[model samples]
Target: MQDTTDFEVWIEDNEPDGYEEIYTLYRSVAEREDNGIWAVTTNGDKTFVTGPTSTLQLLSEKARRTFLNAVEALKSDPEMDMESWYGYERNMANSKA
Candidate 1:
């Protein structure tokens, strides 16, 4: 997880206009990543899932579902079970398909 400092830097870089601003920040970080794919916006009910399409396409169907659910649990579902949330991401990363 990113620290408060990293989020502060992003806010300083641009006004938090909407999901596009969030996507720009996500893209910058994603470009540096070599593995894994997942995303979510932070706009209340208007929020949506997002991420690099190419990276997501590389995932197997099961992996894609796991990754997406993991991200959602982390970013959006505060009520989700902690054990389930972390295990899903761990397995998604370890899985070959």
Candidate 2:
């Protein structure tokens, strides 16, 4: 696995908006079946299974970056809402089909 600290720095620099980019990256990572199960957790401690990963290490790095970015964005934007973030993620998933 890549150093999560490095991934954190990358995410901090990227500062992705909403959940679209992260969600899409996660879905792509999850589609690979050889890796272990991928999961995500929210600040509220809610957890969800993302999928089976073909590249567990890589996906772990991606997840760490994504989650870090999400947390940062949420903190930066006080008005940011989780419902909207989830809705955006769903829409991105739908569009991928």
Candidate 3:
């Protein structure tokens, strides 16, 4: 597994109709009984998934590119603010709700 020191941007399909989308930054963390990915949305919603790798692979190409760019920026600047930097413009559409 890759080192998960930084949070990763992730995307999930909200429904079969493809009308809704959920975007998040996730980190692998340990829980009392098990380990999982802790996902936090721009809207401040929190969720969890058992397998981080699978969930990461599910992201769309555009989302994947955004995530990679964010990661690269973080590598250059350790103090970068993820919330503001990661999905700024993309989340504008989501923020309306």
C-alpha local distance difference test of each model: 0.35, 0.42, 0.32
Error of 3 at 75 (Å): 2.0
RMSD values, in order shown: 15.9, 9.6, 12.3
Residue 86 error for model 1, in Å?
Answer: 21
lDDT of 2 by residue, 26-74 (tens): 4433343222234433333222333332211234545544654544354
Candidate 3 C-alpha lDDT tens digits along 1-97:
2222223433222111111111132222111122223332221222223234433332343444445454344322345454453355345457673
Once fitted onto the true fold, the runs of candidate 3 whose alpha carbons sit more than 4 angstroms away are 1-58, 77-97
lDDT of 1 by residue, 15-86 (tens): 333333333334433332322333433322222223332112212334334433433333323564544544
TM-score of 3: 0.23
Judge candidate 3 at residue 40 and give its lDDT: 25
TM-score of each: 0.24, 0.29, 0.23
Best by lDDT: 2
Clashing residue pairs in all predictions, respectively, total: 0, 2, 0
**Full ranking by TM-score:** 2, 1, 3
